[model samples]
Target chain A: MSLSIRHSWFEATARQRLAGLLDPGSFCEFLPPAVAQPSPHLAQLDLPGAFDDGVVVGAGQLGSRQVLVAAQEGQFMGGAVGEIHGAKIVGLLRRAVAERPAAVLFLIDSGGVRLHEANAGLIAISEIMRAVLDARAAGVPVVALVGGSCGAFGGMGIVAKLCSAVVMSEEGRLALSGPEVIETVAGVEEFDAKDRALVWRVTGGKHRYLMDDCAALVDDDIAAFRRGSIELLDDWQETPDTLARLRAKQARLQGRLSAYGRCRDGLEIWAALGISEPERVPLLDCDELIALKEGLPT
Target chain B: MEKLEFKFPSQALLAAAPPALCGVVGSGNLEILVRSGVDRQICEISVNTSARGFGETWRAVLATFAASQAVGGTSIAINDMGATPAVVSLRLAQALADYRGGAQ
Candidate 1:
């Protein structure tokens, strides 16, 4: 409960993160494990099912403001999205649109869709994306926090990008295709899964923050994430999704592609951004990195 | 996957006891969901596990748990992914302690 004691966000479970992020005794879980239904599909494949379907969705107080929260449990099936899992998130987003909470904090830690429930999982992810966009369009801020073991990959990566803002720790990764999957399909020569340094450089939060993908970056501490969330809420302004805003985002994406499309590594991309010592970027602390980004030309 | 059920006699729980959940149904792990409003004299447990042919092990674990904890008028559901007997015993104690509003 004391913010002074460092609590590693990456090590904490989904429930534990919720307890640490929200005010004490403020969390009221939507589908507590006791009554919530587990995935029906897992049983057909003789797999164990988790109550709450590996995702915890509920309403809670963040600082003094009421917020809706959902955290994916990476320990279970890599926090893969299933029919029930995606539905819970969609339900929370829908509630956000109606209730218009201070914000919707999505603690994303999933590796994407559940492979066992392949097609169903894909469909569920699509529905969740739609619900997230719908919530944002209705002037509800959907903020994503990424600092878990699984990180955010596959469909969930897209969902995180669709949010109003994203907060990430250096250990948090955000990418579409995971490294292992890429290596499996494209061969290790293309993207070696065993190359830990390369993997982090490509998908980790520092790269994302420098590229202007994530709105904020913090340490791997739960208290830091809580502080980041509170700061975002304090600076919150209702910017409903619109055609013009989407076009602007698309233009920024096009600019990034044109600028560094041929860069093979994260260091190259940072060098192109005019960082004199791109290799040293990783050694910089959170404050130092943010200061460096500020000094860079837009 | 296999489903197993067991019941044991123990002391009754208070009527207003809150439900508690412990652990996650991960590989080599299990989750225990405990709720009150069951038969006052019996503690019922149901297990849905990925590991088959381990009913006897489950029975022994639950029997020991029931003997140790006053968990009557409660129902427990366990979703297990091949957790060992020791892990099961630990989770059962933690779940019961959590149910009784004690530190986990």
Candidate 2:
């Protein structure tokens, strides 16, 4: 099997990523461009609307088991969830409830809501969260893959956390608030958008994986992502230990708050996690980082 | 909040017909929706821009596009932010190119 070099998973468009992830010739796109169902809100706001509204969703086969997929086009408005785009995602998860796909994959690459349609976008995200929880209750695994330049922030961050598992590349950043927004609202002294190293140290995949915020952290390659996801499909139980898992996640989050609530620097958190030479973690290559993680004393 | 409409004369449809969308609505960017209209001899253009007092410029730019492309029986709708004339033309042409399933 030859890998496509034209649009590697890290650099591929939303459509290309979908094609690369799903089984060959088994992917079927819903709400195709020919349907031309753009956002009515954009028209009302005098903003141009996309026919598929930044999200491509549909059913596909993943190694024989049926699955549903939704990939966001980060190039489009940061892949923000507006009315139509959010509705499309919600619709897919809802369908998963009745259809009972083996799993649902969300290729998240959004900065959350579209400010132009803030109210509608917010409500749509809320609906999507509910749909995600409902699908999980129905025993369908929810997986989030974050790798695009936009990464995931705002409400989408919370949505990603609610998933059964998250697969992220070292390039992926998962945070509740973006660096620029933090700087603007909290002052540059609190967070500087210009400080790329600091930004990555705080929210990069390595940090999140070490903190247990994300499940798997892999290299910035589509093949690496593919291996990570297939491992989840094969290893993860269909019906997870929901109660125990929730409780464990709750404990981990509580530990974070208690341990780092007062810390201002990301290095402090890294040092507390027992990483030597904390500053170098951000500079380490993906393979080196993974090896270091593997070599950690258990 | 400004809306402008224009009609152009042509006999052949664009490379792509109606119901095709190209572009995104970003900070200073815009989106274009191309639809096939009933009439075969007229190409319709409508624009709604966030910027004000650019009606004449829009008309000039769009008129030139209509004359050059000679797109017929198509209804083009645009949502613009503060995109310049150059960006606007590029987006319009890109929209048409994408509608034809060509490389962007």
Candidate 3:
């Protein structure tokens, strides 16, 4: 029998996502809620305390290969990263490099940092970004999965893009600043902040896929995302020349700069990639959508 | 955080298809994205605002546009930092014009 916590991570339970990602009965959540590893900064600010500080990082396995996993909690201040939260990510990424696990999977859904902690959150996120890049230098596969409605923005979005592979769902979105924030910074006349379809067009999974930023765009189920992650790991294992492949990947990005530099909108990219009907492209069912162009890597 | 809600009925009209858009995702800025389906029938709009309490007014502006224009089946998404009403309609219209080329 399993012991249930009084609180949950979000709409889906933490262990539930873990179970899907890891082999059956293989997950042992480290620093779990019941273990009482809450955020220390909360007390300093007179803010209500939280368990686990909204991030869960630990070691697990994908089939027989070992993997490091980190999942952020969206319920807690939209899963903002604070000092401890960002530290946990850095620590695990470092450990993952040392262990040379088959891969590292980060379940991200954050607004970047915890404002209550101010500079701590910002600094921590900065460290987290460096850690992700380090994981790449070490040749460990890093996969960032967007699993919540928060859609992973700000610093988190930038970090997520640097992963060796990105697996986002139909609902996943990635942006430097969210729609409302953009309207404020750029002026309402320059941009419209009230259009949901417009926002999703630039950031949603379909858009990311069309842009070559997302490795695989799956349905809205965790099982699908997990399955995609497993396959990505398997592909890396089969080749084992991850670094060489990625360099070629970056070279492709350099090559495409001219084409995408002048172009804007997901449809343009879709059309350039040979989706003859760019206007009808977004309306296509996932199955009907054309395969992505051969060479870009995120 | 001050939240403002209003509408710009295309200052003209607009639409999305595998849609396209422009602008920055920055503090105090907004991004315009849309999929203008080839349909000349309807434009479906859903604005998730940090500024609460303008649903009816939003509906009114939308109604005004719908009554005048026959835009249909296009999907739109907007992220607002606090844009005024006129800018809203103008950006949408500009997005429509730019995308008529199926590029940025």
Highest-scoring model, TM-score: 1
Worst 10 residues of 1 chain B by lDDT: B10-19
| Fnat of model 2, as a fraction | 0.52
In order of TM-score, best first, we have 1, 2, 3
* DockQ, structure candidate 3: 0.01
Instruction: Tell me which of candidates 1 and 2 scores higher on TM-score.
Output: 1
Query: A167, model 2: CA deviation in Å?
Result: 1.9
List runs of model 1 lying over 4 Å from the truth: A1-3, B14-16, B102-104
DockQ of 1: 0.84
The chain A TM-scores for the candidates, taken one by one, are: 0.97, 0.93, 0.84
Error of model 2, residue A51, in angstroms: 4.3
Candidate 1 lDDT tens digits, A167-268: 999999999999999999999999998998899899999999999889999999988999999998899896876799879989988998998999889999
Model 3 quality (TM-score): 0.65
DockQ of each: 0.84, 0.35, 0.01
Locate the minimum summed-lDDT window of 10 residues in model 1 chain A. Answer: A1-10
User: Relative to the unseen true structure, what is the C-alpha lDDT of residue A40 in candidate 2, on a scale of 0 to 100?
Assistant: 77
Cα deviation at A81, candidate 3, in Å, is 0.7
Candidate 1 C-alpha error for residue A251, in Å? 2.5
